[model samples]
Target: MIPRLKAWWRMFDTFTQRCLAVSVVLAIVASACLVQLVNVQLLDGRTTAEAATNSRTSKVTLSAKRGRILDTNGTVLAQSVERYNIIGVPDAATSFTPVTCGSKQAKSLGYCHAIDDKPVGATGAAAVARLLAPLLGMDAMELGAKLNGTNQYVVLKKEVTPQVKREIDKLNLGGIVYGELSSERVYAENTLIGALLGGVDDEGKGASGLESSLDDELAGTDGYTVYQRGNGGEVIPGTVTKTQEATDGKDVSLTIDADVDWYVKKVLSEGVSAQHAQWGVAVVQDVQTGEIIALEDSDSIQAGSDEAKLGSSRAVSQTFEPGSVGKIPALAAIMQSGVKITDQFTIPYEMEKDGQKFHDASSHGAEHWTLAGILQNSSNVGMITAAANVTNQQRYDMLCKFGIGQSTGLNLPGESNGVLTSPESWDTRSKETVLFGQGYTVNALQLTRAVSVIATGGINRQQSLIKSVSTSNGKQTSKLNTSATRVIDENTANEIKNAMESVADRWNKVINVSGYRIAMKTGTAEVAGDSGALTSIVADTVGFLPADNPRFVVTVVMKDPAGVHGGTTAGKVFAQIGEFLMQKYDVPNSAERTDAIPVEW
Candidate 1:
C-alpha cells in the first residue's frame, strides 16, 4: 500500500498535494471536536441538565400550620386557616399571554389557546387586569396601573377566598400567581377568649397571654421546597426537585371551661357596666385540684380593635388590698397560734395603735364577741385584738405560704405577685393594719388561692392553666401541676369554713341556690390614688360552695364601682355566676345543715 500511495502522489502537482494534505488535517480536527461534543451532551448529561434546571428554579419556604388552642371541653379558642396572596409580577405581566388552552390553535401555535380570549388574541397585562378586576372586586384601571410598575413581585391582594382563587384559575392568565400562606391567628371564639388566647404578631409569633408564654410549643416547624419555575415566574408542574415535609405545631388544651367562662363573663360584663367601673374580673377554681375553670377579664381587648394599652388578665396581674377577704387568712393565722374560734374578746369600734386608729366598716359601741363573730362582722378592731397572738413575721410568712407575694405558677404571661411587705419593712402601724387586711396587697387570683386553703383542707395546690400539649405525631405532654403543700392544719381550715358559713347565710338572698349550702366572704378595700391616698374601692367577694365539702371557689372583683361594699357590688356578680355554675354542674346540696358558730360568748 505504501508503494501505491507514493506512485499516486508523484503524479499530482505541488498545489494539489498541499490542498490534499490541508483537507486531511481539517477533517481530523472536525472529527475530534465532534467526539468532545458527544461526551458533554450524552456522557455527562445529568450534570448539564441540572445546571440548566437550576438557572430557572428556586427554593420556597413553606409555612407550617399553627396548632389549635382548645378549652378543656375540646372547644377551639384559636386556630390557623389557609389563605392565598394574589401575587403579580409587574414586568412579566405587562407582556404575558397564555398560549395554551382547550383544543384551540393546536397546529398554529403547537398547543392550545387562551381560555378567556380568542385564538391569537391580545392577552397582555391590560387584558389580564380587565378580566380579573371585577372578580377581585378591584377597579380595572387601578389593577392596570399596578401591573405597569417595575416591581419584580407585587401583592395585588391578600387573603383571597378559595372560590375566588378557583375563578382566577379558570381564566388561566400566565403572569398572575398565587403565593399561599397561613392566616394570622383565627380566633374561633373571637373576643370571648381574646386576651387569654393572645394574639399573633405580624411575624406569626404569639405576642401576649398564653399564646406568648407557650409560643414555641404552638408554633410548628416550617417546611421548604425547591422547584423549577416557568418563564413567567410561576412554579412549573412536575418540576419539583427537592422537598421537606412541614411539621405542624403542637395543640394546647387549657383547664378553662368555656361554658363556665361564658357565664362568668356575662355576669361580670353586666356588673362592670352597671357599676360604671373601670373593669371587672371573675375567677372560678376547683377547690380539690386548683384548676381554674373561669378567669374572666371584662376589660379584655376586643379582637381587631385597638382599644386598650395592655393585655386584660387583671385577675392575675392587678393587685389591691384584700379588705374583708384578708380576714379569711387572718383567722387561719390566729387559729394556728392556738386561738380557738370560740375564744372571746371585748371588741371596740375603733382601736388606736402607734397613734393611728383603726375602725370597722361601720362604727358601733364596744361589744364582746368570739373569734367567729369578728370574721362574720368583718371587724377591724376585733382582728387587731387577735393579732397579739401571732407575730408580724409569722403572719407575713403565713400569707406567703398561701401563694401571696408570688406568682400562682399558672404559666400566664405578665403575672403579678402583688405587694407583700416583709416583716423587716413593716412600719409600727403595719402591725395592727396588716391584721385587718391592710398595708399589703394581693391580686384576685392570689386571694382566691388563699381562701382555697379553707376549702382544700389546708393543702395549697399549685394553680395551672394548661392541661396538655398534643403534637402532630400523636404524642401528648401533660402540663397540669398536681403537687400540693400544706399551708394550715385541717382543723383550722374546717373551723374557718364553718364560721364563714354565717357570712354566706347573710348574703344568701343573692348568692345561695335553692338546694346548696354556700360559704363566702365579702371584701371592700380602699385603693390608693396616684397621690398615695385612698380614693377608690376594690369591691370583691371570695368564697366557695356547699359549706360541708367545698367544690368551687369563685372570686368576683370590681374596680372603683358605684357600691363600695363587695357584698352589694361584687356579690351580685358572684351570685349570678354561682347560681349558673350550680345549675350547670348539677352540684348536689349538703345533706346536713351548717352548724351555727357562737358569735358572742
Candidate 2:
C-alpha cells in the first residue's frame, strides 16, 4: 500500500510542474499580443489627421506692375515701382517662446516659472521696439507687444524703404521678416506734362487723360502658381506645380513730339500776353495729311483754383460767330458764280438794308472798289451783295457743301456743330448778315478746316488726335487720316486763296523773317448782344505757309480783349508762330512773292 501511494504522489508532482510551465508561456504570448494591438490602435498615429487638417498653410499672390507711358521721343511720362512690408513670426518664434517646444509640449510641460517670468520678456515689447523702431519708424514698445506671440506671426511694419530694409536685415532679429510690394508713381521729368498724361490710383489703375482712356490696354492680366505640398506644408520639391506666367502690359508710344509741343505752347503763351487779348489758341496741322503738329491754348484749366481758368481743347469745342472767317465760302460762291478773280464792285462805307447798318472796320467811303477789294477789306455789303445775287437756296447748298453749320468730324471728344439757320427762315437781312457771318455760329476748328479747303485744293481732309490701338492678342488697328471731299473748283479755290493771301500781309510786318509768302485772313467777330448790338470782339487770324505749295495751316484766336482789331492782335501771334514753325520744320521760305492782285479800295 505504501509503495502505491508514493507512485501516485510522484506522478501528480510531475503533472503539476508541466501545467505551470505551459500556463507561463501562454501568459507571455498573450501579453505580447495585447501590447502590439494597443500601440497599433492608439499610439502610432496620434497626430496624423490633426496635423493634416488643423496645421495652417499660408500663401501669397504677387501682382505685376503696369506698363509705362512714353512720348514719341521715348520720354517717360508716367511710371511705377515696388514697395515692401516687414513681418514677424511671434508665436512660432524661438526667441519669443517661453521655453523650448518639444515632446513635453510647451503647454503640458510641468516646469517651475517665477511670477515675474512673462511669456514675452518683461522688456519683450521694449526689446523688440528697440530692435525695430529705428529701422521701421515705429514705437518699439508697441512693436514688442505685437511681436509677443503665443503661436502666431504678426506684421511688424509696412512700406519701409529699401535702405531701411537693408538695415533691418543686418540686425538678424529673430522672427522678423519682410515681403516686397509695389508702390509709388514716378513722373520722370517731374510733372512737366502732368495734366495731359494724367494719373493713376493706389491699385495702379488709370484715373484720367490718355491713361484713363486706354486703361484696358495698359493694364495686363495677373498670374498665379499652384503647388502640391507635403506633410509639413512644405512644397514637394520634385512634384509638378501648376504655374501661369503673368502677362505684362505692352508699352505705348504717343504721337506727341515733346520738344515741338513745348515750343508751341511757350510761343503761343508769350504772344497772347503781348497781344493784350483775353485768351488765344494756336494749332498747326499738316495740309496734305491733316495731322496735328502742335496745339496751344492760353485758356488752360486752372488746377487747384478756378480763377482765369480755361479748359483743354479749346479750338474744336468752343463756338462763336465766325464773322469774316466764314465769308471765304461766301466769296467762293461769288467766284464759282462766274465772278473772275479780277472782278469789280464799288465799295460803300455804310450799306443799309431792312433798317440795319452794315459797315467795314475802316470807314473807306463808297467808291470804285473791285470785288477783290471788297473781300480784302472784309466789306459786309460786298459780301452780301455778291452772295445776294446767288439765291438763298444756292447759298445754303454752298454752305453745306463747304461744311458750314456742321462739325469738321475731327477725332476729338466734345466737338461742336456750328449753328447754321435754315434757308426757309432767311429774310433779305438774314441773307446779308449770314453772308458776313453775323447770323451763323461756327466753332474755331470747323472754320479752320473750311479755310483749309484752299490748301487741300478744294478738298477738306479733317484732323485727328488718335493714331493707333493695339490689342492683347497682337491685333493692331489704325485711325485713318481725314477723308477728302471736294467742295469747289480747284482753280476757283486757288483764285480765292490768292485773295486770302492778302490777309497775311499784315503778319509780314510784325514777324519779318524775310521768307515764305503766307496766305492769311484776319477776322474780328463781334459777339452780338440779345438786344441786337455788338458786345465784344473775338480776334482771329487764319493762315497757311508758302501759299504756292502749301504744307501747314495755322489759326490764332484772341477773345474779348482790350485790343481792337483781329489783324493787329491775332495776326501778330500768327506771324511769330509761323516764323518759328518755318525755322523748326526747315520748310522753304523764299523772298520771291507770288503774283497777287494789288489792293485798291
Candidate 3:
C-alpha cells in the first residue's frame, strides 16, 4: 500500500512541471504581441500616415510671374511674356490590347484578335512622332527614339508658343504632356537698356544689372499644388487635394528718361566712333536731386545677340587719371580753406619738384595768371602752385568730401570708387602731382558728380538710378529721395562756378551753344601704359548748362581719342548733348547775359 501511494505522488509532480513549462511559453508570446501593438499605435503612427499619403498624392510646383522694369515715364524696359514647355513621359500610359472585330475576316477568325496597343508601344511612339514632326519642326526618327525610351519624364522644348501647346493638347496622345511656365523674360525696348535691365538665365533667374540686384523684389513667390496621381504618375481627374496660388512681382521704375536716354546713346555712339577711341561715356544729371536724366556707354548691348555681349558700363566702372578735371575739386578745396580766390601766380612752361616735372599743355613762358586764369587755361604748374597753400591732409579731405575714393551710390553693380591717395601715403611729389590732377584716378560718373558739387550750391547729393517701386494693385509703394550732405559753403561753390564760367568761355571756339551761357571744364589726361610710360590720352569735359542759373550737368569722357585736348574732342560732344537737352527739356536761356571772365588776369 505504501509503494502504490509514492508512485501516485511522483506522477502528479511530473504533470505539474509540464503544465508550468506550457504557461511560460504562452506568457513570452503575449509580451511580444503587446510590444508590437504599442509601437504601431503610438511610436510610428504619424510616419505610417505620411507613407500612405505619399503613395497616392503628388506635388506640382507653380511658377510666379516676374515683374516689369520701367523707366521714369512708365516706359517698360523688361517684362515677362507667356510661354509653355513641351513635355513627354514615355511610361505615362498603361499596357492594353487593341482589337478590331467589325471586319468579316476578324469575325470569321472565331473572335476579335488581341493586337498590341499602338498608343504606348513602339508602334504608337513612331506614329505619334511622325504626326508631331511637321508641327513641331522635330526629327521624326529622333523623337520616336525619345518617345520609346525608358525615361519617365522628358522636356522636348521650352518657350513654346501657346498655339502649339493647344494643338498638341487636342491630339490626346498617350505618354505626351505639356504645361505652361510664365517666367520667360522679354525686353520691351530691345537692347536699349539691356545692360541696365540685365538678362534672365535658363532657369528664369536674373543674370546681371538691376535685374540681379533687385531679384528678390522683382521675383514674386511661387506656390504649389498637391493632387492624386494614377499608377503611371499622371494627375487623376477631379483628384486635386490642395493648391496654393502664385503672386506677381512688383514694378520697378528707374530714374532714366527713355527719350533722353535714346538721344544720349545715339550721340555717345557717334562720338566714340568718330574719335576711333577705345570707348566713351556720356552722362547728364540733375544737380539738385542727383537724378541721372540720361546715361549711355559705347558698348551697345543687343537684346538677343549672344556674340556682342555687353561689357561693363565704362561710365562708372573704368577709372583713369582725373587730369584737369581734378583741378575743379582742388580749387574748391583751396577756396573753402580761405585761400585768396583772386590770388595771382606766375605760371611757367615747366616746373620741377623732387626730381619730377610738371608742365602746362602748351609752352607758355612765365606769365601772370590769377586763380581763375589757371583753371581757364588748365595750367598744371599754376594749379600746383595754388594748391601749395593747402596742406596734404586738407587736399585729401577735399577729395573725400567730393565723393572720390568711394562709390557714387548709383545702386548699380560693379561701380568703382575713384582712387584718392591717403594723406599719410603722400610723398614729396605726390601732393604736387595730385594737385594738378595726376597720380589719382576717377571714373566718369564719379568725376561728373564731383563737378556737380559746384552746380548744386556746395551740397553733394547721392546719385540714384531707381526712381520708384509700384505694386500690382496700381498703388505707388515707395519713392526714393537721394541723400544730400553739405560739403562746402554756398559762397565757395558760387565762386568756383564763376571760375568755371571763364573756363567755358576759353573753350567757346568748340563748345559754345548758340543762346546759352554754359559753365564747363576740360580735362586732357595722359594715359600711362603698363610699363609706366605715357601711351595715349583721355579727353573729358564736364560742366553745367545756362551758367548763370545752372540746370543740367553734362559730362563726356572719351578714351584714347585721336585728338589730345578735351576742348577738341569731348567738348564738342558735351556741347552737342547740351544743345539737345536744352531743346528736349525746354530749358529757357539765361535771363541776362554776363560778361566773360578774364582768361588772363
Model 1: worst 10 consecutive residues (lDDT sum): 303-312
What's the CA RMSD of model 2 in angstroms?
9.6
Each candidate's TM vs. the true structure?
0.87, 0.71, 0.84
Give a tens-digit lDDT track for model 3, residues 159-223.
87778878776554533555556546877553465565666677777666777777887888888
Residue-level lDDT tens digits of model 1 in 13-61 = 9999999999999999999999989998899888999799877787877
Evaluated with lDDT, which candidate comes out highest? 1
lDDT values of the candidates? 0.80, 0.66, 0.77
Ranking, lDDT, top scorer first: 1, 3, 2
Give the TM-score (vs. native) of candidate 1.
0.87
Per-residue lDDT tens digits of candidate 2, residues 436-534?
A: 666787776666777788888898776654445544465545554557788997988887788877656644675344578888777778885557678
State the local distance difference test value for candidate 3. Answer: 0.77
Q: What lDDT score goes with residue 260 in model 3?
A: 83
Candidate 3: where is the Cα deviation over 4 Å? 1-56, 93-122, 229-238, 303-311, 530-532, 595-597
TM accuracy, model 2: 0.71
lDDT of 1: 0.80
